[model samples]
Target chain A: MVSLILSTAVRYIFPLQLLFSIFLLLRGHNEPGGGFVGGLVVAAAFSLVALANNVWTAQRTMGVNPRVLIGVGLLAAAVSGLQALIAGQPFMTAAWIARDIPVLGKVGTPLLFDFGVYLVVIGVTLTIIFTLMEE
Target chain B: MMQVNTVMNIWIVLPILIPLLTAVGAVLAWNWRRVQRVLSVIGSAALLGAGLKLLLTVWTDGILALQIGSWPAPFGITLAADLFSAIMVVLAGLLAVTVTLYSLASMDMERESFGYYPILHILLMGVCGAFLSGDIFNLYVWFEVLLIASFVLLTLGGERAQLEGAIKYVTLNLMASALFLAGVGVLYGIAGTLNMADLAVQLAKMEHPEIVTAVSMLFLIAFGIKAAVFPLFFWLPASYHTPPVAVSAIFSGLLTKVGVYALFRVFTLLFVHNIRYTHTMILIIAGFTMVTGVLGAVAQTEFRRLLSFHIVSQIGYLLMGLGLYHPAAMAAAVFFMVHVVLAKSTLFLVSGVVHWLQGTYDLKKLGGLYASAPGLALLFLIPALSLAGIPPLPGFFAKLALVGAGLQLGQYVISAVALAVSILTLFSMIKIWNEAFWKPQPLAATCASAQPVLLIIPIVLLALVILGIGFFAGPLFTLAARAAEQLSDPAGYIQAVLGGA
Candidate 1:
């Protein structure tokens, strides 16, 4: 019963951490934190959830397997790189936008690449932890 | 400036994206083996198609660049494909298809239940991303992606050897990563921009000889560790042999080449002005790498271990070409990279078949497989000979190109060492043939069902590719030459990246 209450509180914290990770990634371009660190933060959150719940249960709740997360992350990152090609620039040349929107107006591929970073960290960390847990 | 946009731009991204999406689908379908198989096959096929299409596009266009979010050069992340990157993508795609097919046939269904295809796809994505990325820092990110996937795959089975190997692999690679970051940091501090083309322009303007040497050395060490160059390669043979054949095949084919690609990129573009210092170091390293690597191979008793050692030795040949810094030498490196990928992967696949039949990779315990699996033996023989640089095989032409270039550059010692290494390579192949195929079947040899046709198909296909490159050397050599020329002349590459004519 106590475990159930703790699990509920942990679940509430998870989304908050994920949001913070995204914030870190977005603000990383000129700041100390970036996609790689932000991704690790997200992975750490998922890892905590896995530790609290069973690996299988946490995996199910993830809605996608860790490996797939890695794949998607890689895809997202590659697509971010491709954005340069589409604009007739060289490979991995960074592109951006600085528009005035109410909320997140100045979003760009760097942030997209950061999202990819988040996915990879989560996928890789979970894969290592879960695979070890199985052993 | 005139702009030309084509569907080929989409093709450039698909090789990386398809596997990534399929990996996700595989995980979601983890409970359903049939769905996983279908998704992997479809994804791999799509990647294959994309790779071929991109190759054709690059052949015609000279180089293709894609700007993310419609951002212009020097400011945006780009995925650019020159002839070299395009060919690497095609090679990787083909290898992925074959390895996936082999995995489908070879992997135990029960053990593979936990999203194996997903991991495979992600690994392929990392490789494809590394190949297509145009920025130095972006390349580092992709390297991490590839390394992490490979780490998972290495430890997938959770065996003691796998765990041990994974630890070493991860530890060594992590060190490489740290070094890579340090190198990037130094380069960034020196040049201001992390994009390869932009760095090239900035580096061209810097006239400080000491700073240039220091930065190049840093890059050399970082890429050297990844490429498994001499003194940094002890971890490779130990770890590579622990994985399943499909995993080993892909790792052997794609992983080290990423390092080679980085070396080729940096040396030809950013550090071209200081060829005397950098190229001379490359020459010495290449010589030691060749001598020690082949010597390590000669000492190995296990098939996979021996092959892993050869991987190091072969890297020497690639670096040798880079050391020469001649157009012909660079062409030779390109040709050799393709040849090594095909030959090494084929050899690993054949070893897989042998292990499947005999349940051992030890030379002493194996014999007489030729009678039971003549087809498998023949499949192994072609790539073995190709790797040994036998005449009429692509490996021979690759070696010939390097040697010819070395001779022209008057690096007689390097040319001579190249020939000596070829002889040693042949000796190593003979050792395998003698122990695994030509020797009498041990009385303890256990028989298994006729070799799985799926596994053999990919091995045979790769062997045929080796032969095809050998037969059609003229056009491919010309292509490689063009790539070398383009890489050597960084003006176009820089212009494309910096949005300047």
Candidate 2:
């Protein structure tokens, strides 16, 4: 019932894909990668985990319910836009940190918005995939 | 200078943003069905308040335009609300609140646990976004968002009938979306702009007027299907009655009207270059849509199916206002839209209550409503009479506004058709009354007891609003007139959005 080679390979591939997805999410504002792409990567990673072993293993790997991710992602995106309104600007007007903050240099609302998108993409894709696979 | 105005425009975004946030909140509370319910209700109330503030701001401060990300005009995503869009957004909020309330009593927990409230709020977000979007492409994006939510809502329980309806519904809507996108792409290719105000400006200066006219036809076909105009309306009656009646109420109330609103917006704003041809074509379509829809209703014995057919006919009336292309006619169209949303949704809710009680939607299997539940009968009468254009009801005034405009414009043939359709509409309403309420009980066991007070509250409140609009038609008419003025002459709209471009 188990494929040793594939499951072992997935252990390495899954974490690598997740790390790369985070990199894409962080670098999205200045580079080719963004939340949507990164989210897809993460989703792909989980799907690979499911394929290599079974959906139950992948479900356990994704610790939280996928719906929670969707909600959090949407809230983050909406709240990022509201920051502009709170700062006496029109809603969704990009506001940025003037100084560099640790490893993330010059954070902005767009990146936050993109992060939300990443989560939503991951949440939605995983939920659909997991539900269908489980069925 | 523009920076100062952006701050004032913050409220303009709330109508869209509130729903988005509400959708998120509802989703987050997915594990707790009660929390999702509370979130939808409170969020919709906030939406209503925000819509009213936005309407007041637009009324006093003129049009408010917001450029997302602080991008400059003609280049950024623009959300502009004139009086018309403001009114629509407010009405949408009202629909949201009432439907959410209705869902409290009507929706089963099985559906609730499936993220119904979240999906509903997401649908509202799409609606508000579509209304506020000043960019045509942005409107398409919002349409997709709402359509996806609707697809989920339509088949949430996966009933066999729902799957059948959903298949036809999604297939047709997807076709319409493709057509609309193709039209938008061509329009962008021609004008090199997606901002509606900018498109209007650029369209005026284009060398090829004929190309613009052809592009206008593309918009007409695209919106025509979505509007469920004649020859493309089979999908509506096929799918609308399949969903939970709360879902049906919102769909019947708002969905097709979006198509109508878009047609009115684009035609009056951008496609005025070929009024003689396009308007005439719209007028002809309006006439057929009315006749065919009413004729279809006369044949349906089931309750919701008849109402579904009436929705198609009513679209014809709204389109007639558009086809007439007069300021008064456009104002009438706006007024008519508000009336239909309230009255039609109330009717659907009433149907929901009846179905909940009687366990069937078939008219033949229903009787003794007047005998068993006279109060429900009376509540139903308010909207039904209003729908039939009876005196002292909003429907009467709505029809008067449209017919008056039609006759004033000297379009006698369409005017005659409009009058004929109203009488036919009355005939069908009377038919329903005779069959469902007035007739004696055909079976004693099938008689429905009194409905829950909570369900009746929405019906009564909506009826009261219909009555309120009827009695206080003066201010509302004035507002509709102002909105029509902006549509016919977009100088105010273009000035506000483009800032002297």
Candidate 3:
């Protein structure tokens, strides 16, 4: 049976974990935090739900197929490289919008690439975890 | 003028770009299996066209290098194609198109829906990436990409046999990757550069040449495992026959060759300081690899398993050329690579058909394609005889080149071994012909008269490609000669990549 105290604590912890993961993703371009660590944090939060609740509820909370996430992440990374190819330069040349965007600083392809990495990390890790747990 | 540069540069990387987008296209269209099939085939066709263009560009313009992200040489990742790499890309594209088409008709519905096509394209992308990568670290990354994809493809069906095969395949290959990465790490520490060209320059000038020689063994073992050479080859025959026919066919055609390619690339580019020890060691390994592989083939009763053993044997001939370490020997290796890919894949595809028709690959349970299906027998014989190196076939000419080079260099023992190996190879091939084709009908009336159009098309296409190589031996030899010449002189490659640095 699910422990009431653990379930209640996870409910409060999950939202904060997601917020921290996002913070990691945002800071990834320059600082130590990036998509990989950020994704792991989110995956850990979801796993806690599976421990305190159940896998079905965790899947419901995520509300997206892991395979689809992989596809989208790969698409984002490849397209970021392709945009440079289209712009008559070598592939993956970082191009910036030339303006600082609020808290995210100047936006560019590298940041997009980091976000793609974030998505793939989450997709692959959860795919492994879910498959093993189910087994 | 700038537009012209962009257009030319675009051709150099299209082999990789097309497949990456193709995989992404297949993945994103996950909900629609029909769309995925059409997309995969079309993507493969496009890759074939791009491969041809890339080959043509490399033919006329010479070695082309792209500094990705416009980073300077020895710093940024680079994608480059010389004549040899371009040819391999073309071969990869050709195999991709054939296998993708074959899978459309033969792949199970479960594997189809579970992301098969996407993963297949990703494997192609990794193969092309490995062929085109100019940086050593980038090469390792591409190897992992392809290896990971191969692992997933091998286990797609989740059959007990597939799972068993995949576990061995995964463990051995992961060890190879660890060795490869460790080699990379140590090389970087010594040479302080990840660019292959830059490393060649620095490695050549090192004060203690013996340390570099010691380090070369790491690559030999690492690549030897991938190439399935000598002691490192058991993983291949153990796991290769376990996959679906389409998967086996492509793996037979291209996967081990990637390992061989890395061996050729690394030895010629960076580790030429002491040819006496290193290349000679390869020569010894090549000889044993040939003997063991053919002997294993002689003992196999199953069709696919026999073919897997032969892949290892065929690699021996390629290595014989490398072991000889002359320009003509290298040229011979290049020619043999192209010839064997077509021949081996054709044989595998024919075996797929045999299994499909009779519902078994066991020779004891099989017989009489000769009586019921003369055309299929002919298809099988063309590649079988070619593989056995009969006259006027691609295999004969390829063998002649290697043996001739071996004799020319006075490496008489290896040349003699090469000849003896071919005889054994012929004996094993004949065993298959007798058991599977020439023997009397085992099932009698159950032998169907017709084969599926989809299955026959690829086997016939590849066999005809084998025949084509036999017919146009002169031009193929010329291209291989040019590639070998480029490999013979690392200075041109180093200059082209480093560009006045």
Candidate 4:
């Protein structure tokens, strides 16, 4: 089973997978990656953890329930869309910024929207995986 | 401070922002049920206030627009609230408040593992955002927001029936999303701008009539699936009856109306010039949709299923008014949509109470509920009769407006069909009354006990709203008429989106 493989590999690879997911989420707005893809990657990582350690352990390790993740994701996505309203623009109007920070420079609403998408992807993906595993 | 001109721009964003903030607040308050309840109530109330405030401002001042991130109009996303969008936001907010109250009493906390209040708030946020978005692509994003929330709500309990229904609901909606995306792609390719107001301007200047017609047809098909218009309506009745009563009530009240709202927006603003072909097709479809939907209702013995089918039947009237395209007719369509939301949601909730008492929504098995639950029966009667278009109720006036508009246009055949459908609607409602309320009690003493007051209060309040709209038809009708006028004349909308002429 996939769980067997995940269990063996999770002890060695979870942190790297988590880092990969964050990278995907952060780079999504400009590149081919974004919230949805990032969320999926994160969910896949969690699934690997679940497969290795058992669903409960995986759930506990994530530190938040999948359903809560979904709620948070929905809230995040909605907030990201509403950012347009703050600027006197319409809903879900993608707004961005180019900044020169010490290391990172740009931030925008699309990235936020992508983050929302990431949460939704992780929430939905885990909801399915966990529910199926429970069954 | 010199009176700045930009204060009004904030009003445009208020619609989406209030609900979004409230959703977050609701989630954060989830650990404290009392705080969650207070947050949800106040949040929705605030949204309602914001919506009304925007409506009044628009009524006095005309249209308002906001440019996100200081970007110029054509390139940046625009959030504009004209008469039409403002009214929808207010209505959506009001319904949301009532549904939240209803859910507070009805939802099972154990089964609702995720934060139920938060999801409901976000769903409202999505609905409001969709109504307020000025661009086509943004509308797609809002639709997905609402659709995903609804999918979760639909299958919340994971009952066998709920899961089955959710599968059909999700799959069908995904297909509709694909169709919507395709339509947007074609439209963007042809017109070169996804902004609705900009598209309207460009589309007006384009010469190829055939291409315009094809694009309009694509929009019709895409929105039709969402609105549950005749050919695309089968998925609605199948899935709608499966969700819990409160979830079903909110879904029935708000979701399809958003679709209807979108169709009206796109057709009136963007595709108005192609009236002959599109209008004629709409008229034909509207007529069939009314008759067939009612026939489906008549065939149903279950309370929820019957109401689900009736939702389809009533949508026909809304579309008919739009198809007529007269200002009065469009106003009637707006009025009809408001009436249906109030009436249908009341009926669905009453059915919930019936199920709580008799353990069934089957009409044959649900006799003498009137004796046991007189308050519920009365709550049921108002919307039921209103839905059947009985005089002095909102539904009656809504139907009257549509019928009058049909007659004014000399669309006699369609008018006649509308009359026939109204009569059949009455018949089906009476059938529900006869089987569910008037017949002798089918159950023992325990089943005859009073229903939960918490649940009944929301239903009664909604019924009151129905009556209030009916009695004070002047102001609301005027509001609807103003929205219709704005819809008919896209000048203000275009100007607002293209950054204030």
Query: Model 2 lDDT vs. the true structure?
Result: 0.90
Per-residue lDDT of candidate 4, residues B1-501 (tens digit)? 102425666676776777777776776566777777788888888888888898888888888776665566778777778888888888887888788787777888753436677788778888988998888999999999999888878887788999888888888788888998999999899989998999999899988968988988888888898899988988899999998898889899989999898999999989988798898899898998999999999999999999999999998999999899999999999899888988998899989988888888888778997787787788889999999999899888888989998898899999999999999999999999999999986655356376677888888888889989999998999989998998888997898678544
| CAPRI class assigned to model 3 | medium
Two-chain DockQ for model 1: 0.26
**Model 4: residues >4 Å from true position, as ranges?**
A1-100, A105-135, B1-6, B26-35, B443-448
lDDT of 3 by residue, A60-85 (tens): 89899777778788878877887888
DockQ for every prediction shown: 0.26, 0.83, 0.71, 0.27
Clashes of each: 22, 0, 0, 10
Worst 10 residues of 3 chain B by lDDT: B1-10
Model 1 bad stretches (over 4 Å): A1-135, B1-3
**Candidate 1 docking category?**
acceptable
lDDT of candidate 2 over A56-128, digit per residue (tens): 9998999998889999999889889989888888788888888878877669998889989999999999999
lDDT of 2 by residue, B1-501 (tens): 577777669778888888888888888888899889999999999999999999999999888898887888899999999988999999998999889899998899899999999999888888888888999999899889988989999999999989999999999999999999999999999999999999999999989899999988888888898889998999999999999999999999878888888999899889998899999999999999999999999899989999999999999999999999999999998998889999999999999887877778888877778877888889889998998899888888888999999998899999899999989998998888888888875776554476777788888889899999999988999999998998899888899889975
How far is B220's C-alpha from truth in model 4 (Å)? 1.2
RMSD, one per candidate, in order: 4.2, 1.2, 1.5, 3.5
lDDT of 4 at A94: 72
Query: Candidate 4, TM-score vs. the true structure?
Result: 0.89
